[model samples]
Target: MISPDAFHAACLGLGAGLALIVAIGAQNAFVLRQGIRGEHIGPIVAVCAISDAILIAAGVLGTGALLTAAPAAVVGLRYVGAAFLITYGVMAARRILTPKALESADPESSGSSRSGRAATLATVLALTWLNPHVYLDTVLLLGSLANTQGPGLQWWFGAGAMLGSIAWFSSLGFGARLLRGFFARPASWRILDGGIAVTMVGLGVGLALGT
Candidate 1:
């Protein structure tokens, strides 16, 4: 049986993980868009959850200290992520301008070709790994919190955070299908892409400015 201390640590980890992830950001936005389009949901969710697990484990294993010592690495990631986000935002803007790029929300009509799947996987990987905020949040912040749980229970805390990541990505990717009816309209896609463009560009600017 799990001890009360272990359970409490796990609960705190879960809440903290959720709090960090539930915010609307580039990663979540991409996942939501893919989910709504019903494209590669499995791989997308798997990548996100697995990436979080790895990051959280690293943090708990004290990699956060290494990261802290290497401020230049984070700076590099910031510029790279900002560039990528801005480029992606411009692409989204192109989709808005090019009506031909907009497609029906029907899963059957979605891009399911091999190349499309490969591209999607690559994009998700970049979004997960390139974001410096992820390192700060999952590694530095969560790691500090987990260590505070004491050596005996830090792993339990990490496990709870991993569970939180799994549950969230699963729910976001799978639950998004429920909104298919709303996205069925092409105009709705335009609006969604518009929002994505703004979000991505704004985030890119913030990251670049180090704000």
Candidate 2:
């Protein structure tokens, strides 16, 4: 039988993961674009959500334990992830503050290519894979916590976390479609991106501090 601790940890994992995952970002941007365009939203969302589910589940099952069991390596990875997250957050905040003045950002960007779906999927995959903080949160922290529930509860806890990821992304992707038309103007997009940037930066900071 699963202990009360395992159940509790699983619920915490779901809440924490969803709290951060539900926000806007590069991946969320891709989902929003697809949802608005009404192009391959199902596949894109499924891929993103499923991929995230797998990673999160793996983290809980034992991967986190393996990483965390090693004192030096875990500490090293934690700091690395923290540094990356802090840097990413600062960059996101900068983008939000100087939306127009940012010379490096492309002021005019549009894509109507036939392979947009594939490109979007690839981008989401890369975004998930490249994020070190994700590993820190999902693989190390969540994983270690989930393992505490023992075998009987780990899978269930993972299921809750998986559902959290799916629900949040689905809502974000579909909800953004309705507002796509209102964002026709450059100023509108700037505001939207600015919002996303702030959210991303805020989440990034939170990840760095493990708060």
Candidate 3:
């Protein structure tokens, strides 16, 4: 049975978690686009939420200390993540120039291609794992905060953070269907893809420069 103080700590963690997870970023943009396209929404949401849970758990378990001791690992991840983002951005830009790529988002587009599904899965995983900001936010920040609650209550706090992750991803993924009508137009696809390309490139450059 949980005590009152532990439960209170959980509430605090939940609020903090929601505040962090609700921010706009590359992962949210990718999830929103995939959600609007109605492509592998369940799998994508599951991957993101589960990934967060794992990270949050790691943070509570003091993995942040390990990271602090191993700065080189983080540096390597930053460069690799930056490269992936830039490459994906270029692909998005290419799609804007190719009529076929733009048309693939049409309402009548078929999901019969196994390769397409695999590609989407890969992209989702990349966006989730490759971002250094995720480590900074979830592991370092959250871990430091959870430790403040003391060992007796930290796990409860982590649980609350995990719940926050699940709620935010579910709302973002499934609720994105509300924008389906707007995305139905080809012009909308062009605009969305263009924005995505710019965002990805900008983030990649920032990561590469370690800014």
Model 2 scores a C-alpha lDDT of: 0.64
Query: CA lDDT of each candidate?
Result: 0.93, 0.64, 0.87
Q: Write the residue-wise lDDT of candidate 2 on 8-43 in tens digits.
A: 766876886786676555567656645655556677
lDDT of candidate 1 at residue 170, scale 0 to 100: 96
List candidate 3 stretches off by more than 4 Å: 104-108
How far in Å is the alpha carbon of 205 misplaced in model 1?
Answer: 0.6
Model 1 bad stretches (over 4 Å): none
Better of 1 and 2 by lDDT: 1
Q: What TM-score does model 2 achieve against the real structure?
A: 0.65
* Per-residue lDDT of model 1, residues 1-211, tens digit only: 9999999999999999999999889999999999999999999999999999999999999999999999999999999999999999999989988977788767898869999999999999998899999999999999999999966999989989999999999999989998889988888889989999999999999999998
lDDT of 3 by residue, 19-72 (tens): 999986788889988888878888889999999999999999999988899999
Q: What's the alpha carbon RMSD for model 2?
A: 6.2
Candidate 1: residue 20 Cα off by (Å): 0.4
